[model samples]
Target chain A: MDRRSFLRTSAVVAAGIAAIAAGLAPLRDLKNFESVEEFLQKHYKELTPEEMKQALERISREVERQYGLRPHVRDLKPMDGVEFAYALNLTRCIGCRKCVHACVAENNQSRNPEIQYIRVLKMPNGTLDMEKGDHNYATESVPEKGFFYMPVQCHQCHNPPCVKVCPVEATWQESDGITVIDYDWCIGCRYCEAACPYWARRFNFTEPSIPRDQVNPNMAYLGNRPRHQGVMEKCHFCIQRTREGKYPACLEVCPTGARKFGNVLDPNSEISQILKNKRVFVLKEEVGTLPRFFYYFDV
Target chain B: MIKNYFRFLLRCARIALVGDWRYHLWLGWLAVICLLGLNAWCKQLVHGLIITGMSDQVSWGVYIANFTFLVGVAAAAVMLVIPVYVYKNKELHDLVIFGELLAVSAIIMCLLFVTVDLGRPDRFWHMIPVIGKFNFPGSMLSWDVIVLNGYLILNLHICGYLLYTQYQGRAPSKWFYIPFVFVGIVWAVSIHTVTAFLYVGLGGRPFWNSAIVGPRFLASAFTAGPALIILALQIIRRTTDYHVTDRALLTLRSIVQVSMLVNVFLLLNEVFKEFYTGDLHASSARYLFLGLHGHHALVPWIWTAIAFNLISMTLLLLPLSRSLRWLDLACVLAIVGIWIEKGMGLVVPGFVPTPLGELVEYTPTLNETLICLGIWAFGLMCYTIFLRMSVPILQGKLSKANETPGEINRVCPAIQSRTATST
Candidate 1:
């Protein structure tokens, strides 16, 4: 090659390499690289029982390693002939936010930048309009006169728009009438977040941080396990607890006994009774999500 | 024949590598910006999407907005292709390549914008067609994934075939590319329409739940895309010896003019539907066009875009725009104007009074903005390299007959002289 042309080519090459090197310098910030086992993990449904056991062991180890908490993690299966449903009595709810905090604690949600599954909407007595509902009402009070508390969470809809919009089938409706997300499979496109009318889903924008003592010992594959950054999460109806025949943390914490949960398929279940006899309604029925959650009033 | 094709690719690569100081400087600037963007992206990877202004409420921000606009730009290639290929407009006969090249670059940018927007970009393989789960026929996003990749491949094949044939000094087989061109025209529409469907299919976002979104997307895309081409063609004419006829620019101008009007008309229809009817769902539109409950972050931006569109549309309609200066101004106006209208004006409002009626305004963070700017720079660099390689081949300066690779520097006197003088 000629001297001048050679110089030009070398100069360009040098500049290019230098630029790329400088650009990649920030990669040093990637402290927690994924293990080969984690990276090559199969989709949730595709995993065999042995693989799932290994996965659960890995999660327990990860939780221990990260937070010094050795928790019991399991892949809880839904019971056959059971379609779980929730019923909330509006007249009994006192606008207290214990359910929200209990959920955060039980779900192993991030504490500093708190991730709460339940949002209690303080609504006026006159209208069903959610526009008038105040999510951020700060007062030292319980059921401030003339206002009703309406808690919103994942409806686990029968006709889930969120599931339909998911390009990767990351989030899907489970057999027991609960919507679930496979964090490992989710690409985090946030399309499901946009499709949900209830604003039920939440994305983990950063690495979830929880105090060591605050980490819930009990975990589920699709529920209360500590989530990685950049995945979607929501109320999976306390899957770890519920799949084991225990009530959801939110219902257990409701001081007024307003929250009710049971298998809708069972004729004598509280939820089935609420639906059959009580004056029950679902929020945003016009959107046609056909929610599993029912609201009722006994005033 | 295969050996000759390999030789053609090598020669093209060589041509791209050796350019004047101006080219080097331009490329250097782009590379630096791309690196800076890469740096920012790395930070985002480490920190996660918390670095961006997006939250659970406003899940999509600048990235999705840019992706939407660039899809329109990419689809605008069909605007030029239809006239030259189908209608046989001689003025744009040679110029159609430029539009296709732009489409190629714009689509790459579109894909990049989507990539950077992803929270778990590491799991991108999950969306792949066969190997991955591939939720086809159910998700609009999967459809988008199909149409966009299809359009990109279609454009690349057309451009590659035409250019390779030119380098060999042979007539291109009409059958190989002609059918694809027709398919491309329809494919182009599907790309933008599918992107529109991505927004419109979301019944949760009332601001985007309108029949007019698809037509509006096409209209705005045609306007901004052609407006950008007219400006690009003018720059190419000034810098290079390649002839870009005034008629070509004028034809594109006319397209921009009509589409701009249609774009405005469609926008007006949306406004009337939102404001005149004054439904409860119109809160987002009310927040956008006029401040709602004193939270008016986007009101100024929407107004500026509207003003730019109106002024540019008027100028494009006038005889004064027959002059290049007025035409240039109008094109610039239309490009920037439609960018805002189609981008932030459209995407942001859909999330403004979010599905829950909570007013959470979005403002893109520095890291997000850097990544966006970086993608744009990379796209521009790609277009520049594509032009650098293709122009010599189109002019017959880098044909197979040259045989000896060393003959390139001797034959291309314009480049050598330009480099010599610049140095």
Candidate 2:
């Protein structure tokens, strides 16, 4: 090469190196890297029984290392012959927002930039219009005047728009009618987040900053397991508890017996009775999500 | 055959590397911007998308907005392709390659914008074909992934084949490229249509659930895409010895004129429907055009874009735009106008009122803006480099016969005109 051409080539090389060097500066802040096991982990459905066991063990170790909490994590599968459903008594709900806090605690949601799945919209009595509902009704409130509380979470829709929009099969409807997300598998594109009419999905924008003591020990792989900085989490109907035959954290914590949860398949279940007896309606029925969750009024 | 291809690539790389001070400066400026973007992306990776203006409320923001617009730009290559291949317009025969090159760069930018928008970019392989669980056909996003990557490859093949054949000083095989060129024209339309489908298929976001989105996307893309080409062609004519005719510019102007009119009409149609009905579903549209419940972050943006669009349309329609200066101004206005209209104006409003009837305004952070600008700079740099190499090949200066680097720089006017006319 001539002197002029050699200078040009050298200049190109120097600029590239400098650019790469400058680009690498901010990477010092990066604290997380996928472990080999985590990186090579199979999809939720594709995971064999033994691979799943090992994966669960790795998660337990990681959680212990991070929080000093040796949590009891499990891959809670749906029960056969059971399809879960929820019903809420809008008249009985007082809009206290205890269920919101209870959900956060149970779900291991981020505390710093708060991620709450349940939004108890305080709607005016005059109209059932969701547009009229106030999400930020700040007062010493217990069913203020003509306003009634309607708590909304993931409907776990039969025709889930969120599931349909997921570019990867990161989220899917379980056989029991609950929509579950494989947190590990989610690409965090958040297409599912945009597709949900109910605003049910939540994304972890940063590392979840849960208090050490506050970390719930009983975790489900698909539910309350601690999420990394950049994955989605939402109300999975408290999969850790519900699949084990316990009521959801929100349902259990409600002061008014407004929240109801049971197997819709069982004729004697409270949800089944409510479905038969009450004047029930699903939110945004026009959107055609066909939610497993329903709202009812005691007129 | 492989050795000859490698030799062609090396010559191209050398041509790209060795340029005048102005070229060095332009490349340097773009490099700095790309590095700035890379720095911002690294920070985003570290801190997560918390650094961005996006929240659970406004799930997607600036990145997706830019992604949407760049997809349109990539699809706009069809405007030139139609005239050249389908209509057999001789004026645009030589210029269509530039459009294809621009598409290649624009698609690269689109992919970058999508990558930066992703929250868990580390898990990107999860969407890959076999190893990953790709939710094809079911997900519009999966369809987007396929169409976009496919379009990129199609344009690359068409551009690369044409340029490499030119370097070999041989007539390009009609069988090899002609079929692909026709496929590319349909593929271009499909790319933008699929991107529109990504928004329109979402029944939850009423703002994006209109039937007009698909058509509006195409209309705006054709307008903006050709407008960009007009500006680029002018720049090429002024800077390089590349022959860009007034007739070619006029043809592009006409394409821009018709598409701009349709784009403006579609906007008006959407505005009338939203404001007339004034229902709850029109909350997002209200938020865009007029402040809904006194929170209109996008009112100024939408109005500004509309003004630009109207002014550009009027200029393009008028005989005054026959002059190059007025035409250039109109093109710039159209590009900026459509960038705002198609990018932030479309993407942000869809998430403004949000599905839950909550009002959370989205404003891009400094980091986000830098990343966006960086991708644009990177794209321009790529286009510049592509042009730098291809212009020489087109002029018969860099070819198999003129193998020596010294001889490649010598202007052969006789060979240049013959090569130009033959192609």
Candidate 3:
């Protein structure tokens, strides 16, 4: 092509991009509508009861049309008033894996026989236990021993490293101190998986292996929805259930009442009382993770 | 004459199949079957990573280790290139193309290994575009992508120009030769350094956070890469009419001797920092070399690596071994031992007791092993095709290279349009 035509074509492409940028950048300051922040910041859960019911119906219809199957989709998940917190009694945890099972059923994770959010480690008590723990342990029985349980999951750190390392900005911390992942946006690079000191992040290697009847009907859009293959997922502090003032199933089912769930900000809440009466601590204090969940000896 | 023509046709077919066509074909078929096996593993995409031997406890595994090893192979080829192309050593000059081609193959393998380790492959394009997803500036991921892609382009450009000139029966342009030499050296160093940065900057993994990691990687890469090139050349020497003198081979041995010495010295420096003080930081190396909690899995492999390196260094260092026929055999042994030792021995031990204080053993899955073999076969296949394409150019027989770079710029229809468009 001639130079004049080449220059003209290049200018036309540049103008097309400029037009799109002009349209979107000023849409933030819409006088005809509300502000972009005002539009986006309205928590989906804060919608009117009628609006939430409409969303549920829309999603159920969409799922059936797309998958040729009906998936339970409900948005009774209220978010205006309630907050979530979790506390663990260090002295009571026996590494029974019951909490792990309770999480699988309650959170509606795939019954692949191995997936679990909580990992109770048989950490050696006292001595220089600097760097020795087994992650791939297949010991079926919880042996009676001089071992302390270090229940590990996402710390929901105030300065979360996983969030900073995400190339796609797919993971973020919320106002309620819960860290959540955008399952659709996550590329499964596992850079965050490496960045996390806690090893809490898990990758979807294939489609989740849930039987059709067992799949959870009530789903959160960004929280615990059936994740796509090759994305990262982790504990979201059971955000979907906790947003509605309901206890996480794992906390509800704990036989020893070992788990305590409440809001940390409320001075009169059970976790706040537990923090005052008991010497509670978060793991990896040296790394400055500032964990929301705490473990205490005599809560 | 007809019989000769048929024989020539058969040889070309074999050349298309690459070296030891029957053997290469057998391995190639085996690799194809392994892709079917990968389908079974692919079923775990959503089942969560629970499908693999890897768990929340043993978060990273065989995939990462192979990534590290393949990077070493890619970086190693520069050892051959720099001496020949930059220094213009007459003995090594003719062999530089082989190194460049070898590097191109290794880089492709490195990329494939990284892909295999991903939780999802469909979202790979998330790293592309001039926009949102692939955070380029501050990320080690961006550094990896840039340096790797840049080196591949640089080498292919150099490879094509060299062949093109030889085909046209012309001496190479001063313009092409000068820039290629400068970039070749930088490109050689960049592959391993970027790979080292992947681990070294991670402050959490105590095993990988050493400052000397970059230097150590380069030292191993330079030594092993040349050893691989030399071994490959020896096979080509036996099978084909291409020939190099004994003295030229001896010069290569000396380069390896110096490289191995530097590599071992660096290892000693790393070991000294780990053991000099009785600190807890010293334990990761100790755990790898001596069994931690009585698990001595990597011991035999590391020891064999040490022995082969020592034997190869001895032969290279000694004047008598340089002349001995068995010296070549020793070189082959050292190269194989180092490839395994670097690939598994370095990678697995570094992550043994992970940052979370989890010690999970890693044995490559059968699919991972088979796919790795397939990658190697594919690389060899590429080499054969490249050589067939390259041989005529190298021997000064192609039509394209007769014109000067300036002449091609002036008269070529494509170049005229490109320059006109720029105007």
Interface RMSD, candidates in the order listed: 0.9, 1.0, 13.0
**Per DockQ, what order, best first?**
1, 2, 3
Error of 1 at B401 (Å): 1.9
Error of 3 at A24 (Å): 45
Kindly report which residue pairs in candidate 2 clash with one another. none
For model 3, the stretches where C-alpha displacement exceeds 4 angstroms are: A1-87, A92-96, A123-147, A164-169, A245-247, A255-278, A288-290, B1-56, B59-61, B275-284, B324-326, B354-356, B399-423
Best model number under lDDT: 2
**Positional deviation of B224 in candidate 3, in angstroms?**
0.7
Winner on lDDT between 1 and 3 is: 1
| Per-candidate fnat, comma-separated | 0.84, 0.89, 0.42
> Residue-wise lDDT of candidate 2 within A160-218, one digit each (tens)?
99999999999999999889988889888989999999999999998888889999999
Q: Candidate 2's residue-wise lDDT over B1-423, tens digit each?
A: 765686688779879977889898998899889999999999999999999999999989989988988899999999999999989999999999999999999999999999998888878899899999999999999999999999999999999999999999999999989999999999999999999999999999999999999999999999999999999999899879888899999999999999999999998899899889878888888888888888988989989999999999999999999999999999999999999999889998999787778889999999989999999999999999999999989989888987863433343445445545766
Error of 1 at A108 (Å): 1.0
Model 1: runs farther than 4 Å from truth? A2-8, B405-423
Pairs of residues clashing in candidate 3: A72-A217, A204-B45, A205-B44, A205-B45, A206-B44, A206-B45, A206-B46, A207-B46, A208-B46, B167-B398
**Residue-wise C-alpha lDDT for candidate 1, range A91-188, written one tens digit per residue:** 99998999999999999998867888888899988987777788898889887998998999999999999999999999998999889999888888
User: Where does model 2 exceed 4 Å of error?
Assistant: A1-12, B405-423
